[model samples]
Target: DRGPVPVEEGQEVDVTVDSVGRRGDGIARFNNFVIFVPGTNAGDKVKVRITSVRNNFATGEVVKGE
Candidate 1:
């Protein structure tokens, strides 16, 4: 059985971009759950706001970065 996702829409979280997706979105993970953050790059540490959450992955917007 599947559990509830680790994040919710409108939530903010900090993560390091692990890799870039095919469409250029940055990939990060929270509790091993994938979060796709646009406008970020690999090795980027950023704070992102969760925009959409799906069954297997979530999408977020970069709120700030380091």
Candidate 2:
């Protein structure tokens, strides 16, 4: 039931920062795809550039993770 959503890598995504990771990265989910965004704080709304993509998840380098 879970899989990649055909989003290209390095794409920009605007997401609401849901939580904070152990390394201080922002956690957000989109369309059943989980994205780990680095350099952002929780409760922030920012645009992130997708950096890494896996089957069920992806990683984003904060364009606004600051």
Candidate 3:
């Protein structure tokens, strides 16, 4: 189940892709909180819209860039 949310649904944010996850999604962080972004790669700088949030991680989609 989802826990405390750091970001709201549809919240847009700019982040740098730090690493790639096991499923090929890009991993970014904010305040040390993890955000998993699909269709992204390591070292990519992009803007994303938060789609879902959980206790330890969140998921978003790339709104701009690779």
Which residues of candidate 1, in runs, are more than 4 Å off?
none
- Tens digits of per-residue lDDT for model 1 on 1-66? 368889999999999999999999999999999999988989999999999999999999989887
lDDT of 2 by residue, 23-63 (tens): 88778887757898887777888888888888877898767
lDDT of 3 by residue, 6-59 (tens): 687899999999999899999999667799999888999999899998788889
lDDT of each: 0.94, 0.79, 0.88
On a 0 to 1 TM-score scale, where does candidate 2 land against the true structure?
Answer: 0.80
Clashes of each: 0, 1, 0
lDDT, model 2, position 15: 86
TM-score of each model, in listed order: 0.94, 0.80, 0.86
Q: Give me candidate 1's TM-score against the actual structure.
A: 0.94
**Reference-based lDDT, residue 47, model 1:** 94
